[model samples]
Target chain A: MTYINELDTPCVIIDLNKLNNNIKDMQRFASKNKVTLRPMIKTHKMPQIANMQIKNGAKGITCAKISEAEVMAKAGIKDIFIAYEIVTEDKIKRLLNLSKKVKLSVAVDSKYGVDMLNKYFKKANNNIDVLIEINTGLNRCGLNNLDEIYSLAEHIMNSSNVYIKGIFTHAGNVYGAKDKNEVNDIGKYEGNFIVKIKEYLETKGIKVDTVSTGSTPTAKISGKIKGVNEIRPGNYVFYDAIQHSLGVIDIGSCSLSVLSTVISKPTEKRAVIDAGSKSLGLDKGAHGISKVKGYGIIKKFSDITIERLSEEHGILSLKNSKIKIGDKVEIVPNHACTVVNLFDYAYLTDGEKILDIFRIEARGMVK
Target chain B: MTYINELDTPCVIIDLNKLNNNIKDMQRFASKNKVTLRPMIKTHKMPQIANMQIKNGAKGITCAKISEAEVMAKAGIKDIFIAYEIVTEDKIKRLLNLSKKVKLSVAVDSKYGVDMLNKYFKKANNNIDVLIEINTGLNRCGLNNLDEIYSLAEHIMNSSNVYIKGIFTHAGNVYGAKDKNEVNDIGKYEGNFIVKIKEYLETKGIKVDTVSTGSTPTAKISGKIKGVNEIRPGNYVFYDAIQHSLGVIDIGSCSLSVLSTVISKPTEKRAVIDAGSKSLGLDKGAHGISKVKGYGIIKKFSDITIERLSEEHGILSLKNSKIKIGDKVEIVPNHACTVVNLFDYAYLTDGEKILDIFRIEARGMVK
Candidate 1:
């Protein structure tokens, strides 16, 4: 068997045991809370891991784009939820084609999105189930006003082939939480607000089947809420520094890391690794969430800070450290989802032996 | 012919005429200065573009990794220089194997890297050319001391199958310059410093064939310096916002842009696009150079600031702009190199008509 240390530098490695544990833990949490787990495949972007999540009791998988959903569907994932608005004609056409292969549900927030979907679906004589997105603090692509939500839902219902499947919201604003208490408060509001939106839609003669809301930081708290039935947490499969900083997971629970080699010792206190922004990715929590201080966490050298990154080099600020050139170090990235998207393939290991190599099949599906 | 407006959103579009002009202008500048133009291919990572550079009079191509060199080599480029240190045995072996296919030379700064190359080359009964990397200004991975550089060159010369072909430096610090004057000063210093190192090495009985130093912002100034014979500029082929901010090029000269659609109009002052950090990479100069004000520059709406991004959503802070839902906007990314690595393919356009499509062949070659 091959070992991880024998592999090349600047490559991604997933601790298989930790990955299985993370998958099982999240699945168990959703099962115990009576919530349908639709883990977002955008985190791993690997069809094998998504199949494993399905084998461990995930009711469906959620994606950020239709291209990603198409990748999962081609890999035999039967149920897929595209948790984003489809407004453009090319994407709407691709979405209709994708709906023929799997049980697909897309997210919609505006009348423009609904009309685009209706125009295409009506021409093709096909129907698509869509989740009405509610704005619960993450004011990205969701309807916040009750009247707008009502009118959008009415417009979708009046369309020839569009139907309402559920109501969902991503409480991505919890990423800006200062502490665990704030995260808990945001999680409670996220769950209650989406459920309240579902109730209001029901009162308006629109039957919302699924009340979905989640992010990794708020998944457990939100899933446990009374009326929430679906939890779509993406980052829990390989919890990153952002999740750890927000008190969501421990550092040891992080399964994904970029195995890098120290290629240079420029000074007594500065070391350079072979991995940089191209491999590790430059994501420290987008949307001004600056809780993550550095680019990544060096596994055994917590005192060593990854100060900066070039295209192919990561500079480390060492503190009286004996890290020399040729020393191999594994880096836990600040954000796992973006890091995974940078590599073409990742190795599955069990801390000692390389178990298998899985292609990040859905990576760069940004069309 | 298909038109660019009919293409999908959140996709990369390259203006063919501007791209050709950029390539031709850089080549003309290098030729006029009597410097060998060896353009770095990490910016576009497309073999078609690299061939275009070759046709425009670039003597050779430069890459950050051996895998990228292999990609270019497979496309029948004769000469390549991997301007990064290769430390591990596996990579050294790959480097040696790649040398048989083309003229290959790599960079070395530390004795450890030279020793690693020496040990493998001796066993394989083969030799390879290497360039001594000097720390002109960017303290990422190069020797800064004169004594150490002499000792490392001595070590390489004394080895069984390692040869010194040149000395090089990348003045990447020009990205942090406050104004055009500072950039010019840094550029002049960058070219003079490497040429001085080459002269010093020659005085010590070591013959240096190539004195190479460059970055996009410094290439023109450095190439014009008296003794610098080679310049390697990667981003001038696309001339991103970082180059524009450094006053190296005008915004109209930028050839690369992400065609994104306004997916959501959250409020009158806030607009959301289909692109984000995934499409436009979060590289506002990696070493805390924050001269870039936003993620990218919108083509027509200069007042719209891309304030933040999620994985797939770019939130724009608009100023009473009429950007509505389903409106398409072209965004010039802050850094073209990292942004190009985010996609699998890019479309080539001539103003309004689609010319062709090229695969980003060497995109994720971080290893």
Candidate 2:
């Protein structure tokens, strides 16, 4: 059997035991809360992991792009959700094609998006389900005002080829939570707010089937809320330094890391690893919400901060650590999703023994 | 003819005319300064572009990793300089195999790297050329002390299979320059510093054949310095917002742009594009040296700031702009190299007409 330590430097290694445990824990948590888990595949982008999640009890998978959803659908996933707004004709066409392969639903926050979806699906002589995105917070997308939500729901229901299946909100703002208390507060609001919108839509004779809310940091709390039927937490499968910093999980729970070799020890207190932005990624957090202080946390040598990164070099600030050239180190990146996107494949390891290699099949599916 | 405007959203587009002009201009500048151009292929990672550079008078190509060099070599590239230290046994074996295919040179900053190289090449009964990396100011890698440099040079000279060929420095510190004057200062120092190191080695009875220094912002000034015989500038082929912010090149000189679509207008003052960190990259600059204000520059609407990104969505802060859903917009990313690494292929466009598509053949070659 191959060992993870024997793998080439600057490669991604996923702890298979930790990965399965994470999947089981999240699935169990969702089941206990009576909320269907529709884990976002964008975190790993590996069909194998998605299939594993499915086998562990995920009802459906969520994707950030139609291209990603297409990968999942091709890999035998029966239910998929594109959790981002679909606009351009090329994407809408792809979305319709993907819809034919699986039970597909898309997110829509704009009247423009609803119109485009309606136009494309009507021309294709097909119908598509859509989740009206609500802006409980995060302010990135979705409608915040009750009037806008009502009007968008009406617009989607009025469309001949479009059906309003649910309402969802990503409380990504919890990533910026000042403390665990703030995370809990945001989680409660995220669930209550989306369910409130679903109730509001029902009051107007509009049927809202799903009340979905999610974010790795707030998923458990939000999923446990009354009336929230679905949770979509992507990063929980591979808790990163950002999640760890936010009190979401501990270092041992991190399933993924970049296996890098110490390539240089330029000074007594400084060393450099082969993994950089090209391998580990440059995600402090979305909009600088994370409290992560450096590029990553050097596994086992947690005191050694990854001070900076170039394209292919990570500069580490060390204490009295004896890191030297040729020494291998594993780095738990600040953000796992972005880090996973930078690799073509990752080795699955049970502790030190590498079991298999899985392709990040949906990587670079930005279109 | 296919038009760039008609292509899929969140796709990379290279202006063929601008790309050609950039290649020619940089080649002319290097030739005029009497320095051999060894453009780093890490920026484009396309064999076609590397071949074009060679055809336009580049002496060789530079790669950050052996895998990238392997890709270039497989595409019939004859000479490659891997400007990073290679450690592990796996990488060294790959390096030796690559040496058989091309005239390969690697960088060495420590005795550890030199000793590893010597051990591998000796075992394989082969010799490899190495350039001593000098830390001019970036402090990321390379030797800054003269005594250490002397010892490393001596160690390599003592090895049976290792030979010292040159000394090089990447004046990446210029990325943090406050203005053009500072960039010029760093450039002059970068060239002179490596030349001084080469002279020092020579005075100690060591023969150094080449003296190299480069950084897109500092290349022009540094290349002009006497005794600096080689320069390697990667991003000069497709200058980005970081280069523009550093006054290295104008926006028109930037050949690469992400063709994205406005997917959402969540508020009157906010619009979201399909391109996000996945397409544009999150490189503000290495070590936070870049003065770039945002993730990228939205062409035609300079006033619009890409405030933030969420894997598949770019949130734009708009002020009275008429951008709407389904409208196509091109964005010039903050860093071209990282941005190019995000795509599988990029469309070559001669203004509006699409000429060809080039695969990013060496993408995700972090290993």
Candidate 3:
């Protein structure tokens, strides 16, 4: 009922048309590849958006934390996969409760994590499915090679309360790829690695059902590769300036932007917007996608650079500056995931009109 | 009360003892210098802490947004200053409504912002106080020269609905100082700038009342400078790793830290903590205070480097390699303000025991 112009500045605006196009594009890609799409909810963190993805033929939803899974489950999501390791008695207890409510699965890497899961699962007299998180050149988490993964898989299979579902890898390194070809190469390698691991596990009498792998950068290429049965790309739901820089998505495909108002014209060449690091987020062209050279890319003003960000002030440097005081502008942030997490509610829009406001239901679910 | 040992991982923990000491130290410094202390509430974002500052002789509270001022006003705070340019009609109306409830003042760097303010104040049939934001050296937002500031002041004085309160400057560049002496120099320059501006305005028949300037890095030196009548330092309440890096406060004086659990030990050199950019924030040693290198400084693990951050995974490069799975660790983030804004609630602690949970009441108040 409200108009976009009437909304406040420094608020998140999600373009509904682009959003649906992104969702349907990924869903169609998954369908054509014969892989189940289970979009990661960490990017959007909205249950309604997750429901949209599910309604668009997504098999389930992917979450990064137990609390995120709990939020989705509470919103009537039946199948949820917590793509994170849950350790400690407190979290395990919460995970057990969450699992009882929905068909929940978690990702694990170490014997320590598996043992803790087994302990809590045994106490509750319930069995839970788990995926081994394997790092495909991300060097962030997961087993380095098949040997280490096999050991963890054997340990999980030995446990009475834990079931080994499959292996999943986040090819986050593709965010650092040199070009589109490199991104596809990394995706191909990730899919091949998962197929190799699944074949090895089968030979060892450990049947692996799923080989879920892909990041937003590798989503298209990974689903096309054989043996990668599932794709869980989070940021593809709302492509960012970084993804656009990486040539993974078009600039027009970017669905999320911070609607900011020029609060100050400090100089002829410098203007200040209401959106700062707190709204647009402080991700400076992360993961080597450096085409867009600034804090964010200002729409329709290619010459304007969001040069810097304070806690609450965004400084824009301009060459042919037309920005004036009180002018409303939309900025495509470098990273959409962090920007989505920064706001309490995101205004859904259809470019010219406001649709609805979706509360970031799973925000601040770090624990 | 619960013991600190029972608290969850990836949670913000504030040392109450250290916090009290920080508040008292800043208060004593302000008193010794005969300058009014108006602690910026953007650092803590909690009304309880703002009240603590008030009880310790703080003249008022400074906020980065009108919504933050509104949050404090709802919690019964009387005197508040929003230190940012707000231009929209909706915000001006809210600001006018807020001024009615409290002694509210706002910073304006543009005539457009002031015109909007004048329009709203005229509609309400009320006069609102305003501070002219001037840039000493930060190069962010504010008037570039004394002439611009004087023109803005004269225009404001001509306006029937607004009153010129004073001038304010933020020495944010003090964070980028090469050494402590450089920081002092920046602080001194800030004080001198204020003195010159106040004197110039008075000679022009514009009476200047408050000369407020200070950032946490320059708080100790700026308040000691002559002619600086008021100091508004935010991060002094929760001294961060960057402040410690700048030698503004000792590492032990850092009151805010994110408590995290080691979730994965992938290699001898690599360990992953549950706290990542979502918990610790993605500041990356802002303002060029890079002495405490990495994403953050891990307490009691001097040899370990918080190498990088993913969304929910902090990759640690361990030299000594003592951290194990499920072991708890505390991290002092690079920027306390952003870290405080990340979580919904922060655990108040006495180092070893949990005292209370302070809800970040003004969190996500960017609008």
lDDT for each residue of candidate 1 in B27-48, tens digit (9 for 90 to 100): 9999888999999999999999
Which residue pairs in model 2 clash with each other? Answer: none
How would you encode candidate 3's per-residue C-alpha lDDT over B174-264 as one tens digit per residue? 8788788888899988888888899999999999888899998877777787878899999999988888877787889999999899999
- For model 2, how does the per-residue alpha-carbon lDDT over B1-367 read when each residue is reduced to its tens digit? 3998889888999999999999999999988888999998999999999999999999999999999999999999999999999867888999999999899999999888888888999999999999999999999899978988999999988999999999999998888899999988999999888888888888999999989889888888889988899999999999999999988888999999999988889888998889888888888875566578878999999889998887888889999899888899999999989988999999999889999999999999987
Q: Which candidate model has the greater DockQ, 2 or 3?
A: 2
Best by DockQ: 2
Error of 1 at A46 (Å): 0.8
Residue range with the least summed lDDT across 10 consecutive positions in model 3 chain A? A283-292
Interface RMSD of each: 1.3, 1.2, 1.6
Candidate 2 yields a Cα-based lDDT of 0.90
Per-prediction DockQ comes to 0.76, 0.81, 0.73
lDDT score, candidate 1, position A159: 87
Question: 1 or 3: which has the higher lDDT?
Answer: 1
Off by over 4 Å in 3: A285-291, B287-291
The models' CA-based lDDT, in order, is 0.91, 0.90, 0.88
lDDT of 2 at A367: 80
lDDT winner among the candidates? Answer: 1
Q: Residue-wise lDDT of candidate 1 within A1-367, one digit each (tens)?
A: 3998898889999999999999999999999999999999889999999999999999999999889999999999999999988898889989989989999999998888888999999999999999988889987878888888888889988988999998999999999999999999999999998888888989989998999989999999989999999999989999988888888889999999999999888789888999999988887774557889788999988899998899899999999789999899998999999999999999999896899999999899876
Q: Distance (Å) between predicted and true CA of B190, model 2?
A: 1.0
Compared with the true structure, what per-residue lDDT tens digits does model 3 show for residues A1-367?
Answer: 4877777888889999999999999999999889999999999999999999999999999999888888899999999999999989999999899888898899999999999999989989998999999888888778967788889999998999999988999898887887889988999888888888889989999999989998888877878888889999999888998988888877889999988999888888898888888888777555423466788888889899888888888889978878898888888999999898898999999897998899999988888
